[model samples]
Target: MSGYFVTEGSKCKGRPLTTLPVVINRDLSRIINNNLQLKSSHDLEHLRYIAQQRDEWTKLTARIQEAAEASQSEH
Candidate 1:
């Protein structure tokens, strides 16, 4: 029953921010508690793929944020 509750977002223009629950299942919790270690090539490759996806998403998010800021500034 112990997990994380992630609350993200800023209160803009007097709007209330909401909190979202991120539940880590028992298997994942156990794995995390045990200190995850790569045991094979497959695991390493999978980790690399995840890292690449994360990097891509981060870049995309930055671009979107920049566009939004630029649009807002135009007003």
Candidate 2:
């Protein structure tokens, strides 16, 4: 679900600092897409950090699993 609504032709913030809703409207899709790209970048950074920390990868895996589970619960 997206976070913003639309009015007129210009794109407005969904909630001052939130991305707009895409499913409800297409105007918000552009902003939501930018957010997705940023999130994807962050996810890649997390995975890359995990890969670089092989000395403690076992511990890292446990931490990653916990983080994944916590994020899943958020959904």
Can you give the TM-score per candidate against the true fold? 0.32, 0.28
State the local distance difference test value for candidate 2. 0.43
Q: After superposition, how far is residue 35 of candidate 2 from its true place, in Å?
A: 21
Which clashing pairs does model 2 show?
4-14, 4-20, 4-21
Question: Worst ten-residue run, lDDT, model 1?
Answer: 19-28
Q: Model 1, which residues run further than 4 Å from truth?
A: 1-52
**lDDT digits (tens) for residues 1-75 of candidate 2:** 211222337655676443333221222123322222223444445546655888655765455466556667989
RMSD of 2: 12.4
What C-alpha lDDT, on a 0 to 100 scale, does residue 4 get in candidate 1? 23
Best-performing candidate as measured by TM-score: 1
Tens digits of lDDT, candidate 1, 1-75: 112222357435764343221121222222322332344445445545654898854754455466556667989
The true-versus-predicted C-alpha distance at residue 69 of model 1, in Å, is: 0.1
